[model samples]
Target: MLGASFLKQKKALEWLSALFLFLLLREWLLPLPSLSDTGSISSFLYLVAGIILVDMTFRSHWLGLLIKIIGTLVIFHAAFVEISLFNPEWILQTLQAVSEDFSRIVNQEWTNMSIISRNLLFSGMILVLVSLLNYLVLEQRQGLWFVFITISYLAVLDTFMPFNGSGAIMRTLMIGFMLITTLHLSAIQKGFIYRGTQSAIWKTLVVPLMIVSLAIGVGYASPKAEPNWPDPIGFLQGKSVTGQSEAIRRVGYDTNDKTLGGPFQQDDTKVFTITTNDKYYLRGDAKDVYTGKGWIKSDKQLESIVHPKNYIWNDTLFSGLETKKVMAVVQAEGEQLPAIFYPGQLKGIEELNPENTTLTYDTISQGILTFNGAMQKDSNSRLFVERDDSTLIPTPVQQYMDHYQLQAEIPVISEKKIIAAGSNYPKDIEERYLQLPNSLPDRIKQLAEKITEGSNNPYDKARAIENYLRSPGRYRYETKDVPIPKEEQDFVDQFLFETMRGYCDHFSTSMVVMLRSIDIPARWVKGFAPGQEISRDANNNMTIEVRNRDAHSWVEVYFPGSGWIPFEATASFTSPLQVNYDRLANEANEFNIPASTEEKEANKPKQLDQMEEADKPVVKTSAGFSWGWLWGIGILIAVGVWILWKKRQEMYLWWLQRKMTQYAQDDFPRRFTLVLTIFEKMISPRYSGETLREYVNRLQISGDERQDLLYLTTIYEKMLYGLKEMEGKTRSLWQQTIERLLRQMKP
Candidate 1:
């Protein structure tokens, strides 16, 4: 009858409901770090387990008050140690450390508490909370407040932080509603339960449970409406770029650079990978017009392409220049880009993965934009289509290219030919490439002239401006805390005179603006640098992985006889393309001064020369904390725990026997009671009105096992009834009997 009472269905459901409700705390605790500045607590799952175990043992009256306390402590020990619980030394050390933390908490030094103590304290708080919930749910039959609070917490997280609480919210509603309904029904049928009509509680809950379940199902299945307003969190923290909203600062490629300023954090998200014979800058697009704030494309026209064809080139500058064919294969890793990243002058597309993907060229930017199917319109639509009403609509492609092959004609640049080919700018090139906003500060132009005072040709003047911007003490490379231009300030002016520090965009924009100030036709070009070499083959072909951190921008100077030549003006960066400085001085000795051997050596192209050594500078071994090591340790701990759990019965039997020997010396009563308890637990639970003899007889044991069990039961009966004293022989027999019975008890 006692066992039957413990198995009361309604009571079991009450405990289950309380446990489920308490587990919801994980949803709140797990995302706390992401929502705040706190670091993640690693043992959070163990803490939750400890709390649940303590709650279960405390509420289980059959275990007796003393055993319940011991069990709770054992659980705490396991959670705190996270190692072998039987290791006395480790357990003692953990207890001492945890105790010290408790002292700190007592002194009101909350911040001084270590992670272990905090988790321990949090577990204690949850133990109290679950007890209170038991009273509220089972005794008082109320849980509306808990449900309401859970909803509010999840709603706040979903609205503000990156935490997606939508699934959690749905789950919370389902469970919370059911819990509340069950508690309400329990309250309504309390009188019936008191009168011993236990089925009344179950019957009363059936309809409410069904109703709650149906309501949850219908609500979940219903279509959700789009958010009625713009994201409040984004509106507050996001910056306006290209007339669109973006995160405060995260390094990546975006179509708009109309407003480019502010510190950006590095993102390791891989954008693409390239397989090629040599390193080259992967050009995305170029912006011809600089608005003093950022860049904008002058021409929005895109020319369609169905097959491989030479890209648009400034024939006046690139005419008859020696070119080498370079083939590269690019595999997209991140989101589909609006344009393909090509190296050098794009000759044409050799192959595409889908074989049906369409391509178009942005005439002004010279960027190749891809499409899913054959373009329905004259030109392929951009990712963001600007309508006539001045509103932008995003056009998502159905299929993104997996990989594409490119056939490019890389122009072999000659510094001698570039300098000797005087700046006889074409009408169109002069109009477009030499553009500068009217609002540009006059001091900026003066600074440009001052920097290039000794320069004669366009190439030399451009080189002088590049060297000045990247020169030490004048500007520094920085990606964080870079200030944006004010309404009255020019972007380039602020970087050049005030901040004097920025990333690639800052130096590149400044170089372009400075070049235009002196009538040197240069434009701001953005792409990825020669990314880190990830692997190399026997044939010397290299595999390069380009991440968001590799997203960069630079200046491209358009010389009439040399086409558009790429230049690197950012500090700590070297251009892959080489210019022959020795030949330049020999070709025009009167105008060009010979550079020193050291300078000429530095200027030599290191594209192929540095491929083998690329991994050395890019990869560094650190003696720091690693998640991989932590995961490995965690896996090992998990396996140990699983093994212990599987052998729990045998381990408990061993521990019981060892403790019995110790208890016999000073505390025979404890030893006797413990033996009887193990018998009831391992064999069968005691029933109401059943004597010790009757319980033993019900076990129906055979052979020697039956005798051992009966003898242990008799000792338990003697201790419980009147026999308060036992001789040494009787106690020894009792211990032996209990040990033998435990050994014979198979799990």
Candidate 2:
């Protein structure tokens, strides 16, 4: 029943042909490996050979199954051979390795050999599925599977990681072939075209050409989507380096995540060492919101510093505070561009080499100072921090807020007591800090409120929540099996209830949520922790060792009068979110000079001119052939050749028939008259009054011509009077005799 219902009713040969064409076109569309790279070429060819072997196994005789399997194995083994194209020893080794260490090869990190090996394995597995398909299902179901495989191969290449190549023409040709093949199958299915027909000129040429033309026309006529993304087409194709957006950051990574997330891992490479008596969290940056799906951007906090002037000498240091200035010289060990690790606030930066780098702020991670390029070796910079009471920055420095905007500013730090500046806080700050997705579980908010119960003020409530996370038996720093929540599943809810196990991201993120649940403003902060001490000076300043293992995430709470205070919530580590440096480091390094008012004004016009110079496009003109025009000419030549090929048989017959018709026009009466006329030229010309028989008798002619002339004379006389049609044999005879007579008569 299965065979009769499907496979028996199907056109096996046609489907096989179509699938082969699909594979061939697909191979053409993908990136080609370099000819010298034997491994890559062999890997690709291995897929092709495997596909053929699998196809034949099902389609050919059942008795040949063992032979097909061996052939496939031999080809696969040959592809994996190293020094020689065909090595028996390497084949044995590859067979052993694939059979024994397949799992190890799959789990290994991406390398040249691994990438090619995995590709070979994946393609081989796909063919294995194809080989089993015939035995498992009917042709109707198999047809669907074949289509799915073909489409999935294209979609994965097009979607997952686009391989850049010739884009439109190859795609159009592939589409054309698919359309033509489909038409052939459909036509044969419905009996529009016969199964036994040897040629399908209409299907091969006309139908496919029409489909391609229509496809192109519709594509141009259709509305185009907006270019919201960079390279909406497959031309610029690769997966985002961050597997998904905003993953946990590691040391030696030049880029930091805007959103803090984990399953965190640590590296032991030191980024930089600091020498400061006060052990405080080296706050790198902060994100204000928890996007349940994990793209936590503080758009409200995002001031673009779009221009260089915004971050460069654009603002003066905070002045309304009784503060002790601290300076530290951070000399980088390696060429890694270290994150500007300042204790309290960044006063200024001076590049050791003016040509080295320019610093920019990612308003996302507040303290991250991104350089255009990596820092040079032995590069060092000085940062000044004030160890004072809680200082609250009402808003990020947008423009230079100098004398006019400084109106009776409340002190950032004081000798006596900390201040609550929330009365003066902008409404935007309050809203941005307390943001939580609506999908956040109510139980999470209840948990936060429960943890912070009985705390009278925001700071006390925040401290209570932080302590709760770092509580002795609450949670541990575990990376293994860290709960990755379902998309709709609340991350905090899962960590807090189902599994009370997580890393820095989980603890810090939970603390922020609990703080926000009670209407207190809180955000996530990430950077290196107060690192381990390496050495101390005579004055009691100790240099520290900060490594990737020291990379951490913590929370920050927003107090009304006091700004953002960093809070450490992870266990097995300790850092005061709010750090106080009563005295500066004795080995104080000078801050890079802030531009004076007059100097800034003078530099303004010069900087604008320089920016204009940088923005301008550099154009260089050279003479060469225009490839667009050349391609147009080539396309036209190809079209002309195609048309000629289509009509070649008709053209050949037209030439032969044209010559025959011309020769035939001089037959019967015309030939006889031409003979007499040539005779007239030879002898004395017969007057118009002379009879035809009389004129012929007067001619001196050869024996065969003379014999033919008497027989032709009677026929001509009858044809002249009667307009009679000559027989086929007589007409053929007359034409040859006349052409021979004309040639003999030539001078």
Candidate 3:
């Protein structure tokens, strides 16, 4: 008879386990509401109750397994769909809407609530009442009615009251309630016996009494006024720009000045606008000479010269010119400078400079023309340049320049000097070129040598190095945790030998230093990478916004007949078409600057020679850090802490029930011989593996006794999982319980 009774008990427990597994699977499959939602909490309670009912009615393992599998499949399907369709933006918007509505209802006078507020209040009230009903069911099962009621009231008060403002107090109370309620329900379903000495009435009464005491304590605490809502615009305005350096630095061009900083900074000031019919290149100051550091105009002295007879110029003068091109006036943002960038070679500049508006040059080998002093605020600046379509034409020479004769006055250097500086190339360029700081690493030079081997000419060497650095096999853009050191010697060496991931600066700087070592007069050029091509207007004018992401740097090498040609030596593989003027113009606005008769006449030999002296190199400073990094780091740390706390709560609940089973088996020795038992009853072995603690936890207990079991279990789990030592009362209770249970269970 005893053996038969044991078999029946084991069968019942097995069926119960199967039912619990099925319920868990079902819950996972459905798109349940967030834990905080009242409706979701109610649904969860019903589901748990349903699982208990099913376990009582069905003892078949096959039926339980089938239900579990089907439920798991449903959940897996939902998870897949959720992952594919997840939109963070929608979640944020919903939270914002909920918060706003809640705030409005709370602040409004009861008699004067708006329609929206009233509706929201009514819905919230309904949820609260339903939640209360669920709490009652939980209390009945656990026999902790007074405790549940008191805790619910305290939580509701904390959520709605002005005390402590909108802080963690409310959230903590709600979480505590959830924990108590879930523990109560799980215990009742599992048939666990509570071993606590305290009666249910006393345990239930103590919670309400404690809540009252807390309410009294809070009333005695310091009083503060309600927090006012912040103005969204004002909040945005107060944000520090220094914190957003990368974002700001991306758009680093001053449309007005047509000059780029060797180092970029973030500023969103608009420059000027353009409305044009034909596509044109917005010419910044042309750089014809490259030092090891950066780009500059040609070294040759400017000579005054008459305008070439074959030149074609736009007709636009100061305000309005009848031209096929479009025109636009752009405004500046913050302290950002202004600039007008157009496609193609400029025909003439109008109202930019009184002394030299018309720029009619036959060709610019590698040099760019600038309207001096035209960057000043009140000065009317405009670039009239012809668009060059052969930007993609390959090496030694471009085909577009075939018809144009080389000017006699233009400086002609030997091909060797142009390719590799003369015998004095290293010595002459050492101070400005091969001059890495004493702190620069030896490995940087080694890498440079490795990349440029066998390349005889400056152009070929530079190209070789650029291709190697830019190849997909060499670099990626992931930010390194331990960044390459900024110390002179360590920076480049670390980048080349250790962490090979970095942004454009590291690559360009390395390229410049290497070229200088080999007698090449390569320099860094900083400007917007390339603006997006805007749609053209009816008249064929395109307007572009040179945003923050456009900031870029590259090397410019001098070519004999063509002036300076641009080459990107960084790891970024931006296509030439993306940055090319004609292609961009074809997609965006094309403005034509008309050449005035006086400007055309003024572009004589005398003027060209006179203006050449102004093309000399100038020095500038570097871009550095602001105050935003601190705040970003703080936000990251806070998010990490919240995740840890949530995980701790889950582990605690799993441990509580395990300990309760130990208390239940203290009176029967043979019946509790083992916490977990394995018996083979079929072809497939049926083996059950569970900890003594886990088996104890599976039984459902209620009221004061249930809380006691939960408390002990939670403490034990924390000790075991957290690797903490059992201490004081908890240690004593665990020792006594184990001794008593083992003594009783001995055969």
Per-residue lDDT over 99-124 for candidate 2, one digit per residue giving the tens place of the 0 to 100 score: 55456545531111222244345445
Q: What is the alpha-carbon RMSD of candidate 3 to the true structure?
A: 24.5
lDDT of each: 0.62, 0.47, 0.35
Which RMSD values do the candidates have, in order?
Answer: 22.2, 28.1, 24.5
lDDT of 2: 0.47
Q: How accurate is candidate 3 locally (lDDT)?
A: 0.35
- Candidate 2 weakest ten by summed lDDT: 608-617
Which residues of candidate 2, in runs, are more than 4 Å off? 1-264, 300-322, 350-355, 362-365, 373-425, 577-747
Ranked candidates (TM-score, high to low): 1, 2, 3
The CA lDDT at 199 in model 3 is 54
Q: How badly does each model clash, as a count of residue pairs?
A: 2, 9, 96
Q: Identify the superior model by TM-score, candidate 1 or candidate 3.
A: 1
Candidate 1, residues 377-443, lDDT tens digits: the string is 4234454433457554556264467888887766656666787789898898899988998889899
Report how far off residue 283 is in candidate 3 (Å): 6.0
